[model samples]
Target chain A: MTETQGLHIAVVGATGAVGQQMISTLEQRNLPIKKIIFLSSARSAGTKLTFKGEEIEVQEAKPESFEGIDIALFSAGGSVSKELAPEAVKRGAIVVDNTSAFRMDENVPLVVPEVNEADLKQHNGIIANPNCSTIQMVVALEPIRETYGLSKIVVSTYQAVSGAGAAAINELKEQARDLLDDKEIEPKILPVKGDEKHYQIAFNVIPQIDKFQDNGYTFEEMKMINETKKIMHMNDLPVAATCVRLPVVTGHSESVYIEVEKEGVSAHQIKDLMKTAPGVVLEDEPKQQIYPTPASSVGKNDVFVGRIRKDLDEDRGFHLWVVSDNLLKGAAWNSVQIAESLLKLGLVTVK
Target chain B: MTETQGLHIAVVGATGAVGQQMISTLEQRNLPIKKIIFLSSARSAGTKLTFKGEEIEVQEAKPESFEGIDIALFSAGGSVSKELAPEAVKRGAIVVDNTSAFRMDENVPLVVPEVNEADLKQHNGIIANPNCSTIQMVVALEPIRETYGLSKIVVSTYQAVSGAGAAAINELKEQARDLLDDKEIEPKILPVKGDEKHYQIAFNVIPQIDKFQDNGYTFEEMKMINETKKIMHMNDLPVAATCVRLPVVTGHSESVYIEVEKEGVSAHQIKDLMKTAPGVVLEDEPKQQIYPTPASSVGKNDVFVGRIRKDLDEDRGFHLWVVSDNLLKGAAWNSVQIAESLLKLGLVTVK
Candidate 1:
């Protein structure tokens, strides 16, 4: 192994939203670390953070910051990842990048650990995490694919505000207060902050989740469609996604309609299969009014599946209600799981 | 037209949540009502209400309350409607019932004036308002159905917390506050309050809108399926719904996937049809990331339709997004529109 009992792990963009969560997930899971380096943008370099009960100074996350680091995790932004991820890898540290910069890169392994753990073995220093919505969908759909071959996937997501980062979550809260007090407020940092206009997400549903792609589908929808095929190793898999933003803080719930290749499979059997799946907690009981929700799923790492049922006409088709803390299973947890997989596989030793 | 200028209008259960909206809608729309009679349960009888800058007293609803009333509106619970709507009709007052009690009854015409204004002439004293989800969908789909025959319909709704009534709305607010403030909160009024357990709606999606029926579809889903056919005058049309309650306050948004009988229909054609449809506002412009949002739709009577696209490889399949203020178009506005139609049709005559 790289080190006897500790590995020097540098967290790139450690002060940003998902960056902070990645740090927390690492510490909470009690990973073996010799040194925890907090790296942020140049403007945030003077900041301090408490890691494992000790105050650590944040450094600017440039290519040079990867020097002497074992594994560097990137979650700052797409531009930040595009610029610095390869630099960290060139410095002999494996990079688990959370941004979408390299996810669709043919050579890079877009890993969800549960779906493609073996995909990590061939990674050339950089491992890409799928989009938050795509991550949760693959976790729920992987077991099904293994048992019954998957043919088609149609998912409608009830995505959370935090997926847009910390600013959008704050916007949801502020707008809700302004609405309650009957005060006039303008929306900011939602449906896409860089887009022309923003919409209020406190008590609304935003049909657009990301920038509109050329095919009239939002970038988020295209991510799910593209990433699902890649993760399942089915380049010809039929996938359609309607990514919608809801007024939730943490958890992302999805209504997924999937068609399995096998015939005559019951919803009960699907429910049974998901009940014992890895990183899954089945909470479906329609009679007792029990199902998974974002509020209840906050702060948890498990991808929750509920409301399982077979489509009435299509005997091979089934519907699934999947939910998970978008920040956890969607981002930090999956990233951390990749790091954990790296450790166990001895693919990247901090030597 | 039944002595047009000002007529006596009676509102049953005038002290409840929806009743207040009904009262405000009547005043906001400037309906021609000379005198307004407010009726409620015994416990709410003595309550005072302000309408058009005047305070009216709410009296206990009785059969005699319909006497001398040109038209009566019912928003009391379904049981109260089942017992008292006939009584109001026996007293010669045309009842525009907002409860589910008579929506599916063969004798009662469930009407959304924009969709089935002609159905008003066939009503037998009791005119029923479709469910909140149903009303919005029919308003969006009715224009398309007229131009092209509809064969099969499937819908998955991201409903608001307000659809369960004001208490559920309050619960959502309270729980949101508690969750943001980091306090443990108990949910008591969601996913069917009368059912065994309650779930927090802040970050969750509860698939069961109403109680589960014997056929595995929840009552809310059945309402959409049955009520859509009844409103469209299509008895054998196939329809299915999966209604989910998201933590939104005012508007209900739905992801509707449908297969039409006509082949090679373009999304642009559907957009053109929706533009001229009554009570329909087209908010679709995917290039600039513009579409219908629930927060922007509150306090309006229009049903917002967007995200019109043809499913790839399925020439006859199309996907649409539908949204509306449930309290307005779903309940209050539809009820008031029905009342206005009754006055115009001479179905309600002053004694």
Candidate 2:
């Protein structure tokens, strides 16, 4: 390929919540792209989106949409990814999927670039992006695991409504206004829209996030438990999660407790290590009341961590609070980061 | 005592949030109260309140306020209780303190009526009501501990702003309105009122709940830890907590993970036990989307437990989601229940 002719990239689901963030994040990144195309479902195909000050009309995503694409990013729900991602791969484009369709597949590599970039070398034409909650947690824990060797994880999430997508964000705002005016609120989307029931997410917290699995754990909880082991290459590690939805519109916060394998590590030592950890910003200052919050972490790509404390009884136990923009680091930014890794590692070349 | 006469009850901090709930809970109960008096700080003195269809004027609380009181319920600040509680006891009043003043005292018994009503029999004078967050969690866990010996507890709380008092609730309302209008908000009284800083609790969850202790745990976290062991009479029970404050107005929700001493106990057995547990409501139907949320648990006195699931890997580990109105089961309702227990146990007599 000539220097002037770079990669031909396509973004599916270009009009959705995380898809919009993908467009903007790609604009801010320095990826060498000769041509960029926007693709979506038949319903959202005709929408116009501005990328890097140029208006691009979205076309309907079909098998032919990936004809000349060198790299394709897919976020158009699990079913869409399940159908279209293989087509894109067959058409010679490396697929970076933002859904859970292929995350646990034996052939596909589940990747958080900070934790497992090398896994890309073994991907069978498709690389899987983890769930939003799992992505941010792995970013914070990877450093600790590398330094101290991790054994177990127990997490409780304070997730945002925007994780459900654009409609859930609108629902939170509308319901909050109605609640403030003392009007009756009718919730249409939240805590799983396709599920049998919908609950108010304005001033309330919902414990269920996705559909419940046969084992009584929500799919969101299982994703965190399974994907953490896959990304960290620790299949025997014990992981537990309680995923919940909060009223926030953008970022997700997690209260994580972990037991390290090595002993005699102090909380201050872990704090000092996190000060320079990749893709993580340490915002801990208890006396000054500085900590990571969902509102404070919106619109950024870094995972913010704070409140690092050692358990009073267990010598190897530590607690951490992690927050990140669910759309950015959890989805779009991570997908783009994987593409950048492909380019840097010479795994995929410009067309 | 004559059959027509009952016990004399005095309510301190009658104008505050929990104090008002205490008065209403008393009115709804059959506690055999001959006379009820409202007492508050000098600032709230002379405020008119209603009890049993009659108006009562709030009086300034002093040592003499408990002269003829048979039972005194204190929800005022810790300092007020510290100064006046012993005086009340000297005048033959059994005090149920809702503050953190005497909860850890060796001589004072911390009581959660559903879990440890018999502990009231050994109270010297003051019976300490545990923290609001702690009270609701213990109520849901005590039945499990009774059937299967308990060993460990790891909890992450989603607490309400009302736990910080009325000013914090107004702060949440005002900040939420300001955020919705796209206006800058000045946070004055959330996370911690007397702490050096205040955070916006409108659409955000704050990791810190109270003043930071030397061990890096917030005072709220320490209360949940220390009080759980004391109330359950298992001083060495390994209890770990991360208490976070959410935007809800009334209910406090918790994601609790526990490991019982017994093995091979299925999640179904625990659900069946919770169905008949005292002061508990089991709302754990995943198919119908029936579960306890902070919004649904508002104004209810019982601790709502749902999302009970056995650990996929650990045989003895299980998780539960517990919620209740922070003001009711957490503070006011628990205090009145303790007063009733005192009468039933013959620990105190009608004057």
Candidate 3:
């Protein structure tokens, strides 16, 4: 196939929540795709999804499914990615894995296009997408870090339920409805979906996100800490994160406190940098009462940053509120953007 | 009247959210009271409320309302407290002001009974209850500080809408219903109820809890920062806060990062301290997926502390998850406890 003929794109887990978003994002994005294929797990296979006004049939993803696929986007789960990602790569497919399976892999380059697109060039067949919370944060901080220099980061996330999967979203909705109706809620999915104890998310905040590691940080918090360092290429940046799941269903909001290397950096200067930063929207205007909220950031692709303020006692420290659609910018849109970057950077070739 | 006759008690803003909680807390506590009077602004006056199986009519609160009141709890708005708190104090009542009006007053002691009940003895007449967010954090950290000594504190709050007031709770409920029904939401209250712009709180997180100050910190955030230093009686403590309002209706949650003066203090030691700390319930067992959450903390009068872990890079820094009912331990219960402390300390006397 000629370069002008575009490339074949396959979306693994196309029947899932983030997968549907990947299809929609692919349709909306200016990616040159000659063919689009939808693939899901055997349980969800045979489902039909729409792509660019055409109904696409989803087949069970397998090793053979990656044949002739130029780029494959995977978000099924870590197990699926661990099993099939290597298979796809073996078949010459450029895989953009949106799971934690390969995020910390030394051979894999975790790409948040705006923050580390050039890192995509070093990809060895598979590119890892950073965690949803890390994607929005790194995008917002990259500009500030680039200008002010960076030393440390402490983030507390007010994350949405959709990050846990579509089932968790349904649990949030049903639980909320049951609560409003004064019915007893049976929580089967939340915090850690497969954990022994499930807590009600209706009008609640769960401090645990993902399972706890031996170090006492949840896997989600570790992802934010580790993946951020990997993407920023700062191994010793001194990052700490506290990840919490809120009742919100879509956008993920983070309260990030970062210490810059430069002294005497003002919040006004940081806001000015964010205004022109790629894939970043500066939404701070205290007098006008303008700032980003999860509901307002829903369906948006750009990371919204606001509430910029210097730390009260630390002149080099600044705080930011970063928000984005967890399904879009955090997962699907970021995955699709990685594919676009691969094509732009000549990391993917049409066969 | 004999000292054994007990003291008359008055609850200002009786018809409001926190005021109702104050009445309930008073009924539950074994405080010696000759009579309980409910009072509100003229707008909310005449509302009927039940306390200890008896219905009481709310009267228009005036200076005369505190004529013989031994303890008066004020939680109306800042303006109401500003106008009536002094009035209550002048008429022989030891006022427990819940609004921000008198919190910073040199003559008024900002008291969190669990942290600084002794400060209650220094109250000129008005004893200020710290902000809900500040109250919970100080309760959780005071124990640690007593053992290890604290040098710095950085907190990010996931506060409930009820902290904004009764109308804000209504807004959250209505907005949730509207969103669930696929109807357009009109947010009339939240962040700051009477602010120029109102944002939807249903399935959303608003970073601004109160009106933004000139320094870009919200009044709620400033309270957490300033009151923390005062309540802990540390004049040179480095404190920074980022307070955000969540859609939860009752409990407020905080992700706090604190640095202890002593090195080699493990998270296990902190958990052990919290397990025995007064008014603190430790719910931290990562293996059991146990942690304090807002929903679980509702209706409880103690600060629930969990998710205790060491900062990845800062050996002296530890992180904690603190949750408490915004109206209970954060406001009304704290007020009632302060009043109890007053009687225990002989700060209040019947004449």
- TM-scores of all models? 0.93, 0.98, 0.97
Q: Total backbone clashes of model 2?
A: 0
Best by DockQ: 3
- Candidate 2: stretches off by over 4 Å: A1-3, B1-3
Candidate 3 B-chain TM-score? 0.97
Residue-level lDDT of model 2, residues B1-351, one tens digit each, is 212679999999999999999999998888988888999989989999998888999999999989889999999989999999999999989999999999999899999999989889889999999999999999999999999989889999999999999999888888888888999999888888888888889999899998998778899999999999999999999999999999888899999999999999999999999999999999999877788998998878899999999987789999999999999999999999999999999987875
Question: Against the true two-chain complex, what DockQ does each candidate achieve?
Answer: 0.52, 0.76, 0.86
lDDT of 1 by residue, B119-201 (tens): 88998889999999999999988888889879867788999888888899889888877766678889898888898888777
Q: What is the C-alpha RMSD of each candidate to the true structure, in Å?
A: 2.7, 1.6, 1.8
Clashing pairs in 3: none
lDDT of 2 by residue, A148-204 (tens): 999889999999988999899889888888898899999888899999899999999
In angstroms, how far off is A297's CA in candidate 2? 0.6
User: How would you encode candidate 3's per-residue C-alpha lDDT over A70-148 as one tens digit per residue?
Assistant: 8999999999999999999999898999999999999999999999899987888899988999999999999888988
After superposing candidate 1, which stretches have Cα over 4 Å from the reference? A1-6, B1-8, B28-35, B50-55, B178-184, B202-206, B234-238, B343-351
In candidate 3, what are the lDDT values of residues B80-139, reduced to their tens digit? 888988888888888889898988888889998888888887778888998899998999
TM-score of chain A of 3: 0.98
